[model samples]
Target: MKILQSKYTNSFFVLLTVTGLLSSCYKPKKHFLQASGNYVLALRTQGTNSTTDYLLSMDTINTASKNISATGNGIEQLAWCYFGSTGSTVFSFSYGTNNVGIGYGVREGGGLYEKGRFSFERMDCFGKGDDNTLVAIGAPWGGGSYDCQIQLIDATTMSIKKKKLTPLYMRDGSDKLNKWPTSIVVNDNKMYVSFYPLDGGSWNTDLTDTAYVTIYSYPAMDSLTTIKDTRTGPIGYYGNQVNMIKSENGDIYTLSPSSLAAGYTQVTRKSGILRIKNGQQSFDPSYFFDVETASGGAKVLSATYAGNGLLVARLQIPGSDDISKLWAAFDVTIPICKIAIIDLNNKTVTDVTDIPVHGGQYGAQGLVEDGKVYLSVTSTIAGEARIYAIDPLTATATKAAKIEGLEVPAIYKIVN
Candidate 1:
């Protein structure tokens, strides 16, 4: 296997132009995949930029964070989703560039740090799922004035072979797929995608909001097929954020960044967990976790199933405001990242520990085995990013590793 390396820089313009030049005009034929690998985590790395030229590292961990290749622009977002088969570990994601548009890649690992390769052209990959085959949603950049299509790509080759699905928005006043696509996850053979339609629409001053999710099924991996059956979400909440994990018992738990109560609706605040059963279309109202926003309201930094009935969730609490410094032009909000152990059987949560972290501090990306939580945080006095491990029972954290090189470091983990 060849070791892939990337160079990090503030510029990606040259890389973008080169990526476009490498793509072939001839389209590849589709194949019916029999099986895939078991991917335990979706390790991702991104530069702390809030704009279009956001860069991403190809290898999640084990390898140093390097910028995506052959592009002059940069990566916007990097995410991973399982495709091909039930136990198959095959996964894919995309990085951004100016002329390169979007660059995508696939890997074959079940651990935190494993090697992978760069594959195809700049397809605006929105989200994906598996039915023995990889079914993805996105459209070509210059395809049309208004064009939305879902294509099925080869799991091994990472090439587009079939155009299977597309959005059929609300017609004659009916509802449709949300325009702002955020995240996608799958349970059983069903695909759950979260999207909000504020992309091309004008920003509204109204407080009332609408977020939507669609549940659909595609053909089996052996069939070079398409999905015609689709269902839209029922009348409910409005927002385009999603963080989901599938439990050992086949239950789907999705986290949202909205309040379930009134008055706190428009704060861009609060934390919530929405539960949905496997192969279901709507969320189970009874299984929801709503954290407060005032008086050090809790925020879910990250969450993952620790197997069995145990779900580990992370929370952060900001310190109280300074009344004496009200006259000052700017203020600092010190944050404390905490971990929680949730007893899913009883639908209850217990505070583990605050994990001793500060603002812009390193935080845990996801949960790990053995009830241990990993976090990357800055030493406020030391001014450096360090990795830490927290024990859930004692609610105490210990320094695990110190990330080198950055004045302020960004660290993420992947496990085999």
Candidate 2:
């Protein structure tokens, strides 16, 4: 094991200067000490095989950690799923495939181990069940052209408990093609599934700005209604989790990137946040925070809610809409992202000072826990991959950990 220590600077002056300039003054939160727990970081190493390693560290600031490599098993692409209640078990899904893997036993001496491996047709997003079950949503590859499938898996035994499918169609009752599930959330015995209804499996500028979410009765998997909203493009993006989050009060909020590649034109709707009130299937008509407008023309790529109505977000500045630029932005090959903290209650956004504006591939890269928000800054522009611990209240960010020679794409905190 190697310890890659990051250089801590006396950069508090920068935050202090910025804090004084903002209308709503920033307040600092309590600092967290380096403690022993299960912390996972995903590194995407370049090679013909596209190898990815899930490194588990017992203590976040310590040098001791174990690596679980996914070199084979046809898992060239992967996405992290939600952590279980115990935080000892975590899940991940492979891109464009039916494969799902579970990593558990983080507290055991052997480090994190693969407890089970299973398959569904194809899944883009996942939700947690009240009875320790995992709900997966997506469509079958090369099949289910006009239908989306949902499956419930027993997380403890890794077995399929039930399955169902629903046909997708336009408002006029015409069959919708190339429509697939992007994200899902389970709340109060009901499941909400967000979908991207593409023109023909690809982006078209002429596509409507409206996105739809279908609500269903959980466990029974019966479709109740499909709701649409034109305020945002979609509830979530592909290849990322954590876009849709539920508050402690049972209200649900989701982000829409509305990226250029997603077929959102300048004249169309911009990226923002939308809320679904508790016990309501439709979006809150009066609630909306236009992130793009707040960022002075930048688009929101991803966001995660910090407790107390604060949301840490990654904003993409306006840039060329060329395909290559879009690919580079998605691959984190360029520094094009700005980290901002959004105040949901006040409807304000403030940029975090002292942190590098760099590129990160996934929107789920930010994790909030124990009064701290951990962000993975994975760009070669900084010369090394590092994680920053943000004090959301004070709006101050400090370099917490570093990964010496790997392009870390995501980080997860697991406690036993």
Candidate 3:
């Protein structure tokens, strides 16, 4: 295995002064302060055959100084991070070569300490985590025969708690060749797993105009029932976590991007948002937002809930697929197309202004904190990586900080 590393730093100091003179007495106050917490950035570097992953932590207020980095081998197509409550414990996932590498550490004294390492089968899709457990759904990476495995691991111990296997596919006995697990959410003693069915290939061109979510009772792994919706495609994509999010009000909302084209034919479907109300198993027939139409035909690539029934979304231009455009998706030289804020209540999308347009392998590269959404806007070739603070209410974006050397694809705010 080979390892590569790089670092850059920029810091800003804010000084506050107070002056007063009373009864022939003069007093002066001077102090410099920086913001608390650090922003964790996932940086991607493309090589001849694979892409390497790097983790960098920079002060939220100052990006110049006090930056730390962790380097690793090439990551698979998808990578994710889990931040603990204290903002110290972190778990990183890297998938490649028919296996998944698990890295765990704690942030201490302004650095990350590697505590342990583990491994899992290839193409394991991550599920949501609670206070104690982390779940992973396993399936075949390429089109082949394999049992769908579910592994529940103890979050703190990093040890397997339980493992269960289902049939080749869901219990429905469907003959679909590719049943890809997209996202998983555990709610009310049941685990909801969303899937995208393809004919039999790596590309998602043979996608059906339908949605499938299999519900299984937790811990027991007993098959409950499969929910179906012909109104939309899959709930989420392969490289995103925010596709299905639970709001503060307890309702669950999911976004779909059906943007694959088959041979001499295209899947003409409107990508939209679907909701599963709190305390319900099926999608609410009364709730649906046509996100594709809202964006004037642009498809939503990734999205995250930004409070108040609003979502900050990254959109791809219509017909921007690599197969159609004759360019590879992993080409770091591509620029981002657009960013917008979607209002679920009014079913509207307002484009955010004044951000650089760059292209990259897109995912849920956004985080919501203190009523603001922090997004990673990095270009593959033109400009440096930048973190933008977006106000969902005003639909405006302002540059927050910058990362040199690498294009950051994901950002997470970890409090200390």
The estimated TM-scores of all candidates read 0.54, 0.79, 0.78
Root-mean-square deviation per candidate: 11.4, 12.0, 13.3
Point out the worst 10-residue segment of candidate 3 by lDDT: 11-20
**Per-residue CA lDDT of candidate 1, range 1-416, in tens?**
22222132111122222123222222331222211222122222322422111222323222224212213222222221111211122333423232121222323432121123344443333333553345555532322213345555554444566664344233234442233333456557666655433223221212224334556565332222221112212112221112456787677765543321110113332455566776666666556555433214654434546666565664444332222211111001233344566555555666654444443211123435357655444444445444455565554566554444221122222222
Q: Candidate 3, residues 1-416: lDDT per residue as tens digits?
A: 22222121010000000000101121221211222235555655544533345555545623324332333322222333222221334455553322334443435434344545567664346665565666777765556664578887666666667888864245345665566676777777788788776544433445557777777888687888777777777766554345676677778787777654211013546788888887678888998888887788876656778988888887766656534332222233555356788888789998887666665443435767778887766665435666677899999977776655345556665544
Q: Supply candidate 3's per-residue lDDT for 375.
A: 74
**TM-score of the candidate numbered 1?**
0.54
**Residue 273 error for model 1, in Å?**
1.9
Better of 2 and 3 by lDDT: 2
Cα lDDT, model 2, residue 1:
20
lDDT of 2 by residue, 1-416 (tens): 22222122112111122112211221231222222456655545443422333444434532213222333211222332322322355665543222445544454432455567676556555666654677776653333366667878776776677888776435556645556566677898898887765544333334548757888998898989988889877656555446777788888887777775333332356778888998899999999988878778776666667888887777776663334343334445567777888787887878887577776464346667778787766656667566677777887887766655345555666655
lDDT of 3 at 257: 70
Candidate lDDT (C-alpha), each: 0.37, 0.60, 0.58
Residue 28, candidate 2: Cα error in Å is: 48
* Regions more than 4 Å wrong, model 3: 1-38, 46-50, 61-88, 96-100, 167-174, 200-204, 261-266, 319-323, 326-332, 380-382
